[model samples]
Target: MYKFKILIEGYARTGANGVYFASPTSSLIYDEKVKVLVDPGTNADALRSSFEREEMEFKDIDIVFLTHYHPDHFLNIRLFPNVDLYDGTTRWHGDQEHFYEGRLPGTDIELVPTPGHTMEQTSLVIETVEYGIVFVCQDVFWWEDGKQKSDNVNDLLNNPDPFMASWKDLQNSRKIVLDRADWIVPGHGKMFRNPRRN
Candidate 1:
């Protein structure tokens, strides 16, 4: 049997691109004693408040997973000094894919490479006894009631890129996730289940 939990800080609005500024939003998935902090948003204060509300502390965290290098997803990386950092391998900073193959203590956590929202954007899939599969996707997929939409294309277009080429990459990544994920906890939206419908 497996278990999971999602701790959302707060919502950070972004451009139509759906970046969500990593404001105060983030989540944690613990396999019993091993905990993984996924995408720490920009609000260290809010994060602390959330912990206090739950009577939890940062020291309880074991690792921090960064989906990409965007400001909203990483500005607070400095907050967790004790947590080991795991990020996408293709990022301008470092390649994290090299470490994706290992298994964690008493749990099964998989980091899938779903780039295109940014070159380094990756997502997490935690297999649980109850939830089946829960994905904490950074910026790879956005939802308008479970249906995949173009929120990201609009945002990414604002940057320098072969628009068509990037769009293709984004589409491919979306398909990859669609094939496996059942429950999705997006970085900046309400939690979702049965993610293909209203």
Candidate 2:
């Protein structure tokens, strides 16, 4: 069994031609001693405030998880240099899936290569005791008005070419995780409780 302490901060927006934002948050799994600092996006002030509210120092982070390299999901990685970082290898060379075991003890946290949103994209998941299972899906899925949207987008969702493969991989990754996950943590919205709530 595993236990996790999760906190949702706010949106980390990227100032590009098209505005991009990420749900910058942090998760700490007590059993594994793993602290995942999700995409800090571009809002340094929000990030700092969130960390303080959670009683966590930026220096205490152990891993930085980048759902994708779209700036909104990264940009803040530079905040931590001492911590070991993990992102889909596809972000660097636009190929290959990086997998490992026991990246965190007592926790089955894996860097799933969920491309599509971006080639260098990845998602984080944890098998927990209380929550059963939770995933830091980032932006592979979007939730609005408590509805789920599929892998479809317009200019509102314009993506780069290198991430095409990652998008396809994202679908496949979703299938596997949906079957096992009980909590769906989106990168820019509220958390989806497994079995859902009325």
Give the best candidate by TM-score.
1
TM-score of each: 0.72, 0.67
Q: 55 in model 1: Cα distance from truth in Å?
A: 2.1
Candidate 2 local lDDT, 2-33, one digit each (tens): 56655553344456786654544444554546
In candidate 1, where is summed lDDT lowest over 10 consecutive residues?
A: 156-165
> What overall lDDT, based on C-alpha atoms, would model 1 receive against the true structure?
0.61
What RMSD does each model have against the real structure? 6.2, 6.4
Which number leads on lDDT? 1
lDDT of 2: 0.58
How would you encode candidate 1's per-residue C-alpha lDDT over 79-174 as one tens digit per residue? Answer: 876566766442222333333333433346666777666655677787877777777775665433334333333332232223122666666776
Q: Each candidate: what lDDT?
A: 0.61, 0.58
Candidate 2 TM-score versus the reference: 0.67
Off by over 4 Å in 1: 14-24, 89-107, 143-165, 196-198
